[model samples]
Target chain A: MKGQRFLGLGYLGPYIIGLLVFTAIPFFGSLYLSFTKYDLMSSPDWTGLANYERLFTRDRTFFKSLNVTLLYVLLTVPLKLAFALFIATVLNYRLQFIGLFRTAFYVPSILGGSIAIAVLWRYMFATEGLVNMALATIGLGPIDWFGDPTNALLTITLLRCWQFGSAMVIFLAALQSIDKSLYEAAAIDGAGKVRIFFFITLPLLTPVIFFNLIMQMVQAFQEFNGPYIITQGGPLKATYLLPLYIYEEAFKKFNMGYASAIAWVLFTIITVLTLIAFWSSKKWVYYAGDKRS
Target chain B: MTDITTSNDLTMDETARAKRRAGLRLFSTAIRYALLFLVGFVMLYPLIWLVGASFKTNSEIFSGAGFLPQNPTLDGYIKGWQTSTPYTFGRFFWNSFLIILPKVIGTAISCTMAAYAFARFDFPLKKVLFGSVIAILLLPNVVTRIPQYILFRDLGWLDSFLPLWVPSALAGDAFFVFMLVQFLRSLPSDMEEAARVDGANSLQTLVYIVVPMLAPALISVCLFQFMWTMNDFLGPLIYLSSVDKYPVSLALKLSIDTTEAFEWNRILAMSVLAISPALIVFFAAQRYFIEGISSGGIKG
Candidate 1:
C-alpha cells in the first residue's frame, strides 16, 4: 500500500513541481510585486498601496481601460451568447449537410485571434476595403473603422463575437441532450413555438447558458489579440482593453509594479463577476437530475 | 341520423388540420435553412475574402469589392515565402513545428500521468490537489505574465523555445489535466484490477491496459495542444525577440510591423499560409476536436 502511494506521488511529481514553480511562485510574486516599485533592473522597493492609489486616483488610462473593458464585456458577452444559442438551436434540427454548416460556423473560432485574421480584419475595414465598397452599394459613405474612436471598439467587438463557435458547440451538445419528449408534450398542449421554447427549451438550458456566460465573460475580460492587433488600442484609446494596458505598462514601459497592480485588479474583477454569476445561478440554473427546490 | 352527420363533420375537421400542419412544417423548414445559410455565410465570409485577396494584385485588392480577384497572381505567394528577413517563411513554419511537436508530446505525457494518479489513487491530499487544479484552471494567464517573464529572464531561458515547451512537459496546463482526469474517471477499473491481481504492477497495468483505452482522449489533448501552439501569438511574441526564432505567428506580425508600404497581397498571402495549417488540421481532426471541447465543457 505504501509503495503504491509512493508510486502515485511519482506519477504526480511533474505536475506538482510545475504548479509550485510556474503557477504558485509567479502568483505570489505578482501579488508581492503589486505592493512595490520595481523596474526590470533593480530589486523591488516596497511602496505599500501606492500603485493601487495611483491607479484609482490619477491614472486616466487605467480608468479608461476599465470602462472600455466593462463596456466590452457588457456588449460582447450577451451578443456572443445570444448568437451561439440562436445558431445552436437552428442547427439542432435534422437537416441535410448539417455537419458542413456546423464546421463552417466553427472554423472562424479555430482561426480566431491569429495575426492573419487580425490583418485580414484591418484590410476588410480599411477606407477602400470590401466593407466600404459594400456600403457604397447601399448608398452609405465609407465609415472610418479604425480611425474613429466610436467605431474602433465596435470593430474589435465584432471580431471577438465572430469567434462564437466554441460556445455554440457547447450549446449544441446541451440541446441534443435535452429529452425530445418535453418538446412533444409541449406541442401536444397546443403551445406555440415561441411559448414552447421559452417554457421548455430555455428553462432547461439555463445551466449551460450560465456556464457559457461565465466562460465568455472571463474570456472577454482577458481579451487581448483582437484590439491589440487590429486597433492597438488606438483612436484616442477607445479600445484600450485592460490586458493591452497591462501589457504596455509592464513590457513597453517597464513598470512591472504598476502593471502587476493592474493585473491584480483585473483578476479581482473576474473573480467577483464569476462568483456573482455562480451565486445568481442558484436561482435560475436548472440541473436535470437534481430535485426541484 | 345525428351520429352519422357528426362523424362526417369530424373527418372534415381532421383533413383541414393535417393540411395546416403540413403547410406550417414547410414554412418552418424554409426559415430554418434560410437562417442557417445566413449565419454560416457570416461566419465564413471573412475567410473566403482572405483567400480571394491573397491571389489579388495590390491595386486589385484595394479596388476589388467582390470575393474573386479580377486577375489572379502567384507573385504574392512567391515573395511572401521569402520575407524581408534572412530566413524565408519556411523557417518560421519550421520554428512553429519545432515548438508545437514537443509541446504536444509533453502535454500528452505529463497530463495523462498526473490524471492517472488523480483518478486511480487514494493518496493523501488528493482532494486538495484536485481542487487546486480546478482553481488554477480559472487563474488567468495574464496575471502571471510579468512574474513569469522575470523568472525566465533570470534563468536565462529567454529567446529560446525552452520556456514554451518545458512547462508543458511539467503539466502546466491544468485544463488538460482536469480533462484527462475526467476521462480516466469515466473508464472502468475492472481491467486494471485484474492486471493487478495477476501481479502486474500499476505502471505495467497503466501501460498495457489503461493507456490503450485512453488513446482517444490523449489524441484529443495532442490535437488541441498542436492547434493552440500553432496559433499561439503571445507566448512566442514575449519570449522570442529574434526574427530567426520567430514562429509563423510572430513572423506574420513582423512583416506587418517592418513593411513600409504594406503590400496587401503579400501580407494576406502569408496570413493565409499562417492560417492554413490550423484550418487543415481542424478539418481533418474536427471530430476529435469537437468531442474534446463539448465533453470537456459538460464534464468540467
Candidate 2:
C-alpha cells in the first residue's frame, strides 16, 4: 500500500505537472499579479489595491461590462435550460423520425461555440439580414437587433439559447431513465400531464437541472465569441461582456495586472454562484439512488 | 339503451367517448409534431442559411433572408479558400490540425492515466489531489490565462503552437480528467485486480486492459478536445502573432478584419469549412458523444 501510494504518482506524473504549471501556479500567480502593475514589457510593480480601487471607484467601464455580463448570464442560462428541457420533453415522446429531429436540435450545439457560427450569427442579425426579412414577411417591421442594446443582448442570448441541444440531450437521457411506472400510476390516479410533470417528474429531475444550470452559467459568464464577432461589444458598448473587457485590458492594452484583477473578480463571481448553487441544491435536487431508473 | 356493455350493442356514450379520445390523441400528436418542426427549424436555420449563402454570389447574399441563392456559384468557396492573406485557408486548417492532433492525443492519454490513478488506487493526499482536480475543474480558465501566458512567454513559447497544446497535453484541462474519473468510477475494478494477480504492472494493465474498456470515454475526450481546440479563437489569437501561424478560427476573424466591405458569401463559405471538421466528427460519433455528455452530467 505504501509503495502503491508513491507508485500512483508515476501514473499521475503528467497530470500533476500540468495541474501545477497550468492551474495551480497560474491560478495563484494571477492572484499575486493582480496586486501589482505589470505590462508585458516590464516587471510587475507593487501597487496593492490600486487596480481594485480603480475598478471599484473610478472605472465606469468595469461596472458597465460587469452589468452586461451578469445580465447576459441571467438571460442566457435559464432561457437555454428551459428551452432545452422543453425540447427534451417533446423529443422524449415516441414519434416517427425522432432521430432526425434530435439531430437537427443537436447540430447547433456542436457548432455553436465556433468562431464560424459567431460570424454567421453576426450576418444573420444584420439590418437587412434573413431574420429581419423573415420578420418583414410576417408584416412586422425590421427589429434593429444591433441598434438597440436590449435587442442586441437578446440576439446574443438567442445565439446561446439556440445551442441548447447538448443540455437537451442530457435532459432527454434523464427523462428516458424516469420510471414508467410513476407515470402510469399518475395517469391511473387521473393526474394531468402538466401536474405530473410539475409534482413528480420535475422534482426527480432537479439534479440534472442543477447540473445543466451550473454548466450553462459558467459558459454564459465567459461568453466572448458571439459578442466579440457580432458587435465587437459595440453600438455603444452594449454587449461589452467582462471577457471582452478582460481581453482588451490584458491583451490589447497590455494592462496585465488590471486584467488579472478583473479575471479574479469574474472567478469570484463564478465560485460564489457555484457554491450557492451547491448549497441550494440540498433543498431541491433529489438523488434517487435506484429510483432514477 | 342497453345497460349491459356488449360489443353488439355498444352504448352511444362509450362510442362517442372512445372517438373523442382518439381524436384528442391524434390532435395532440399533430400539435407536438408542429411545435417540434417549428422550433427545430429555428434551431437549424442559421446553419442551413450559412451553407446556402456560402454558394451565393456576393451580390445576392443580402438579396433576401432565404437560404437558397437565386444563382448559386462556387465563387465564395473558391475565393474563401484562397484567402487574402499570404497563406491560404489550407494553411490555417493545417495549423488547427497540428494543435488538435497533439492536444487530443495528449488529453486522451494523460487524462486517462490521471483518472485511473484517482479512481483506482489509494495514494497519499489522494483526497486533496482529487479535491484540487474538482476545484480546477470549476476554476475559470480566464483567471489563469494571463499568468500562464507570462509563464509561456518566459519559456519563450509565444508565437508558436507549443503554448496552446502543451498545457493541455500535460492534463491542464481538469474537466476532461474529472469526466474520465467519473466514467472510471462507474466501471468495475475487478479486471485490473485480476491483471495484477497475473504479475502485470499497473502500466501494463492499463495499456492492455483498461484502455480498451476506456475507449468510448477516451474517444469523447478526443472529440471534445478536437472541437474545442478548433473553436478556440482566444488561444491562437493571444499566442500566435504571425499570419502564417493562424488557425481556421483566427483566420476567419482575420478575414473579417482585413476585408473592408464584408464579402458575406466568402466569409460564410470559410465558416462552413471551419465548422465541417467538428460537424463531421460529431455526426459520425454522435452516439458516444451524447452518451459521454449524459453520463458525465448524471453520474458525476
Candidate 3:
C-alpha cells in the first residue's frame, strides 16, 4: 500500500485504454469527420459547415428523417410509459398468480425488440395477413398496417411500445418499496383510492418515471430493427428514423461526413433534451427516497 | 314484542348488506383476473402464433390469424436450418456462441476490475475518469459507430467477429462498468479489508474474496451481455459481411433480403429459433434479470 500510488491504475489500465481507444477518440474523431467530406474511397477533404448547411437548407430527406424521428420518440415514449405504469399499478395488488401475470406481461419486453419480433410484426400486419383476418371476423374491413404512410409509423411505434415490460418492472420495484403506512394513513384520513394515488403514490414515483422517460426516449430515438425490417423506412419514408437515415447514408450511400454530421446533430438533440429534462426535474421529480421523510 | 320484531328486522338487513358487499368483492376479484388474463394472452399471442405458425405450410402461414396449424409440419425448420447460404443455421449459432462466450467472460473480468478500482481506490484523476464513464454511458453509440467502424476497418478487423466482441471485452460498455460500480459501492468492504490485512494482494483478494460476494451482480452482467449480444443485429450486420460468418440475426435477415418470394413459414421458424435462447435464459434466471433492471434502470 505504501508504494502503490498508481496501483489503482493497474486495475484501471485495460478499461482506460479501451475508453481512450474506442470511445474518446471515436467521439472526437466523428466530430472532426463531420466537418469534412470523406467517402470511403478517398481521403477526407475539409468541407467547413457545408454538410450542416446542406442538411438545414437543401436536403429534403434530412428534414423528413428529423421530423419522423421526433414524432417517433414523442409518440412511443409516452405510450410505453403509460402502459407500464398502468400495468404495474394493477399488478401491485395482492392477487393470485400475480407473478405469472407479471412474467406473461414481461415476456414481450425481452423478445419485442428482436429481429424475430420485427419479422412477426411484419407478417401480422401484412396485407391479407393475420390482423386482417381477425378484423374480418368482427365484420370490419382490413386496415393497411404497413402499406399506408400513417399506419407504417404506427406499426413501428407499437413494436417499440410493446417492450414496455422492463419499464413496468422498474416501476413495480419503486411502487413496492413505497411505505405501507402512508397508504394506511391516507385511508384513515378518509382519502379515496384515486385521491391517495394521485397525492401520495404518483409523487413518490416521479423519480422512477423520470428515469424510465430518459431511457425510453434514448431508445425510441434510435429504433432501428423494427423500422428497418417491418417497413424498411417505407410507405414513403414515413418510418425513416434518424438511425435508419444514418445507416442508409453512411453505409448505403457512403456519406460518412454527412452521416457523422447527422449523428452529431442527433447527439446534440439528445443532450439538449436530456438537459431540459434535468432542469425541469427540479420542479417535478422529488427524490424523497427515504419513506420516513 | 314490537321492539323485538324491529331489532330482528334490523339484524336481517345488516346480514343482507354484508352478503352484498362480499359478493361485490368477489365480482371485482374476478374482473381483475379476467383483465390480466386477457392482456397476458394478447401480449403472448404473437409468440404463440410464431411457434404454431412455424409449423404451418407457406400457403397456410397467411391463411388466418389463428395460431394452431391444421397440418403441422417440420418443413419450415428443416429448410430454414439449411438457409440460403452454403453455411447452415448451425454455423450462425456457433458464430453467436463465439461472440457471446468471450464477450460475457471479458465483461465480467474487465468491468469488475474497473469497478473495484473506482469504488475502492483513490487514484489520481479518479473524478475525471469516473465522470467520463458517465459521459460515455450517456453518449449515443450512433456518434461513434462510423469512426469505430473506420478504425476497425483500418486495423483490418472488419469482416471478422473481433470488432463485435473486443470493445465489450475491454469494458468499453460503460453501462456495465457503471452498473458494477454502483453494485460495488453498496457492498461492505470489511472482508476485503481483512484479506488485505492477511497480506493478500489486490488481485488475490479480488479473485478469492470479492468475487464470491459479487456473484449475483456478476451473473446479472453476464446474462445481460449474453442476451444483448444474441439480439444484436446492427453489430453483426456492420462487421461480418461474409455469409458463412453471419450470426443468427443476420442469417435470419439474409433470407428476407436476398430472396424474391417470401418464404414466410421458414422465416417464422427461424424467428422462433432466434428468440428461443433469450426466452429460455430469461425464464431460467428471471430473478437476477429483474433485480438488475430494477436497480439499474438505465439499460437500453
Candidate 4:
C-alpha cells in the first residue's frame, strides 16, 4: 500500500499540479469574474446581474449576432455533414487510388480554418474576384457577392462547408466498419442500390451522424474567424457571429463583463442544443451489439 | 450483380430482374462519376482560384473576376512580401516559427507525461480527474478567456508570449492528454508489467519502455499542436499588442485591417506564404495525422 501511494504520487504529480493551477483555478475564476466588471487594468467591481440584463435588453447587436450565429449553424451543419457522408460513400468504393483521394479531400479541412483560407474566402467572394469571373463566363452577369447582406452570410457558410474533411474522415471510418455481408444479403434479396443504402448504410451511420451533428453545431456557434476577416461583421452586421460579437465587445469596446455574459449565454445555448440532439438521437442512433435491438 | 451469383438458380422473374439490375448498374455508374466530379470541383475550386490569384497583377486580380488570370504575373508575390503590414513578410514568417517551435515541444513533453501517467497508473480519484479533463474539452475557450486574461494581467504576463507558452509547458492541453492516454491504453500492458517485475520504478518504466513505443502518438500530437498554434489568430491577437510581436496569423489580419482598398492580390500572396509551412508539414507527416484523426475521433 505504501509503495502504491508512492507510485501514484510519482506518476500523477505533474498532472495534478497542472490541472490545479491552469484549469481548475481559471475555471472558477472565470465564473466569479462573470459577476464583476474587469477591464484588465482596473480592479473588478461587483456588477452582479447588470451585465446579463444589459445583454438581454439593452444590446441590439447581441441579438443580431445571435441570429447570425444560429443561421450559420443551421446552414453549415446539415450541408457539411451531408457532403461529408456523400464523399465518404463515394470513397468506400473499390478505387485504385482511394488513399490518395482520401488525403486530397482532407487537406482542405485543415487549411479551411486558417487565416489564409479566410483571407482566400474574402478574395474569392469579393466583387471582382474569381466567383464573379466564373459568373461572367456563363453569361450570367456578375452579382454582388459580399456586397449584399444575403449573399455575404451564404458565402461564409459555403466556405465552412468546403472544409468538410474531418466529418468525411469520420464518416469514412464508420462506413468501412459496416459489415459487407449485409449488403450481400440485401443484394441477394433483389434490393436496389438506393433502397439498400437507405435501409442499411443510413441506419448504421446514425450514431456517427449524430456525433458529427453535435460537434459541428457546437463549432458553428463559435464561428469567429471567417466573419472577423471577411465581413468584419458586415455590410449591415449581417455576418456578425456571436463569438465575434463577444470579442469586439470585450477587446474593442472593453466591456469584459458584457462579453463574459455573452460567453455564458453561448455556453448555455451549446449545452441545451447538445442535450436536445442527444435526446432526439435516441430515435435514430443504433448500437450494433445491443440486445434490445 | 455479384450478389445474384451467390443466390440459387434464377427463375423467369429473377432473370428479368437481373436484366433490369444490369441496366440500373450502368445508369448508376454514370451518376456516380457525375456526383464525384461535381463534389471534386466544388472542393478544389477555391484553392485553384487562390493559387491563380497569387500570380496575377493588382488590376488582373481586381478586374478579371475569373479563376484563370488574363495576364498572370509574379508581381503580387513581390508586393505582398515587400509591402505586407506590421513588418516585411519575412519577420511574420520568423515570428510564426518562433512561437510554433516552443509550443510544439512544450505540448508534446507535458501532454505525453500526463498521458503516460493516466495510461499506466490506477490512482485515487482517477475517474473524477479524467472527467474534469473531458468537461474542460467541452467548455469553449471564450468562457475561460476573461479569467485567464485577469490571471495573466495580475502576473504582469500580458503582452508576452508567456501565457501561451506556460499553459502548454504545464500540460493544459486536455485533448492531447486524453488522446495520447487512449493510444497508450491501446498498447499492450505486458511489457510494463515485465519491466515492473525486473525492479524498474514507474518513472523508469515510462521513460525506458513506454516513451520509445509512443513515438507515433507523440509525433501526431506535435504536428497538431504545431499547425493549431501556428494558425492561431485569437490568442496572439488578444495578447500581443506590438506589430513586431505579432505572429503570422495576426499579421495577416493586420495586413487587411490596415489596408484602405482591400488589396486582394497581396492578401492572397501573403495567405499562400503563411499557409506553405503547415501544408508542407502536413504532407510530410500525413500518415500520423490520419491515425491521429481516426483515434481522436472515436475517443472524442
Say which candidate scores most in lDDT. Answer: 1
Encode model 2's per-residue lDDT on B251-270: one tens digit a residue: 99999887658577788899
Per-residue lDDT over A21-126 for candidate 3, one digit per residue giving the tens place of the 0 to 100 score: 9999999999999999989889988899999999899999989999999998999999999999988988888788887887888888888767888989988888
lDDT of 4 by residue, B17-100 (tens): 889988987777666666776777768777777788788777777676457887877777877787645478888788888888
Off by over 4 Å in 4: A5-10, A291-293, B1-30, B65-72, B84-86, B259-263
What digit string (tens of lDDT, one per residue) describes model 1 on residues A139-212?
99999998998799898889888999989998999889999999999888899989988999998889889878
DockQ of each: 0.77, 0.80, 0.66, 0.57
Flag the better candidate by DockQ, 2 or 4. 2
Give the alpha carbon lDDT tens digit for every residue of B1-300 in model 3.
999999999999999988997898788788888888888887888789889999999888888878889999999999888887788889999998998898899999999999989988888899999998888887889999999999999999999989987898889988888888888888999999999999999899999988898889899999988888998999998898888788889888998886547677888899999999999999999888888888776322
Query: By TM-score, is 2 or 3 better?
Result: 2
Q: Give every collision pair in model 1.
A: none
TM-score of each: 0.97, 0.96, 0.95, 0.92
lDDT score of residue B6 within candidate 4: 57
Backbone clash numbers for all candidates listed: 0, 1, 0, 1
* TM-score, structure 2 vs. true: 0.96
TM-score of chain B of each: 0.95, 0.93, 0.90, 0.89
Q: For every candidate, give the share of true A-B contacts it also has.
A: 0.74, 0.81, 0.67, 0.51
